[model samples]
Target: MGVFTFTDEHTSSVPPVRLFKALIVDSHKLIPKLWPQAIKNIDILQGNGGPGTIKQINFVEGSQLGKMKNCVDELNEETFVYKHTMIDLKEKFEFIAYEVKFEPTPDEGSKNKMTSMYYTKGNVELKEEDIEAGKERALGMYKVAEAYLLQNPDAYA
Candidate 1:
């Protein structure tokens, strides 16, 4: 097995707490509402959404990826950190783990950092473009949430 890791960062004008609440805490309810064309809904398969919880993300019809399941490894509300690993993998992958951290910026905004680790089967190597595409999708989700919070200031507050 081989592990390949990548890191990316994004800055948002939304506050850290609000962004965290919208993205990490309330993602199950928010994502589908924000992008119904892509995602159907997020369902909690086990636990109460904290560490060790299992969640399933059901994609909408016509999407390339049908669905995926993930387990929450860690979630710290106070620190604005979340870690999860994809329990279901495609043929070429063993697993994919992700860590997200939201930090407060001096301008009362937020600096969000994301790290992704791809575990491949045997000596299979992942393409840089594939990883970059995934990163872009993640960032797009973040921006969607950020834009929602920006438009509705009282939504996540």
Candidate 2:
């Protein structure tokens, strides 16, 4: 198995706490409602919303979409950092451990940094193109969520 890591950052106009509450805390419910084409649903397999929680995400229709099982490894509410391990993947190319950090800027907003580390095995190898594509997809989802929150600020509350 070969391990590879990818990092990307994005800035949000919303506050860190608000972003965290909407995106990380309530994503399982909000994502499907907002972007149904990208994410079909998220099922909590174990725990609640804290550490050790296991979640399975189902992709939307079309293409070779697959499910991903992840376990929340670490969660620091105060620091706004969360880490998860991808325990199962539908295919050979999948993320292994994904760590995301939300840093609140002094300017009143927040910056999101996502680091995805993965291993390629069983006739599959990680590629730069695949990593870039994944980054784009992630950013697109975040952008969609951001827009949805801007329009429906009370949806998560």
Candidate 3:
């Protein structure tokens, strides 16, 4: 078992509270609709929209990722912190986890800053390049959601 960790941060024009609501709260229903080209559905398999919930994200037909499961480890709406453990999507990536913190940061008059910490357990020795693919996927998803909110100001307002 090889363990590796890294963090990636994104800045957006959206406010922290609004972004948190849209990303953590409304994502279950909104993500699939917003990114139908990549994600087909997000189904909550267990628990409420809180800690201990197990959710599955189904990818669009013919994608490399057919489906992926995640366990909500922690969610704090007040502090805008979210942590989830990802089930193995592909055989090589055995266990992947994330702790994401959303905080208001000063940046060109925007209140959006997202810090994502990722932990991955690989089946064999992992290189930095091996991890970029997963990080790109996460970034892609976040950007899509952010774009949706940018276009619809009233959404999750």
Top lDDT hit = 1
> Looking at model 2, which ten-residue stretch has the lowest summed lDDT?
87-96
lDDT of 1 by residue, 1-157 (tens): 9999888988988989999899999999998899887889999999998999999999899877788888999999999999999877888798899999999999999999999999999988798887977887788788788889999999989
- For model 2, give the RMSD to the true fold: 2.2
lDDT of 2 by residue, 1-157 (tens): 6788778888887767767777788878887887787788999999998999999888887735567788989877778888988886656655578788888888877899999988877668777777877787678778888887778767543
User: What C-alpha RMSD separates each model from the true structure?
Assistant: 0.9, 2.2, 2.5
Best model number under TM-score? 1
Candidate 3 lDDT over residue span 45-121, tens digit each: 99998999999999989997799899999999888888888875565666677887777767622344334434444
- How many clashing residue pairs are found in candidate 2? 0
Candidate 3 — number of clashing residue pairs? 0
Whose TM-score is higher: candidate 1's or candidate 3's? 1
Which runs in model 2 stand beyond 4 Å of their true positions?
90-95, 122-124, 153-157
lDDT of 2 at 45: 93
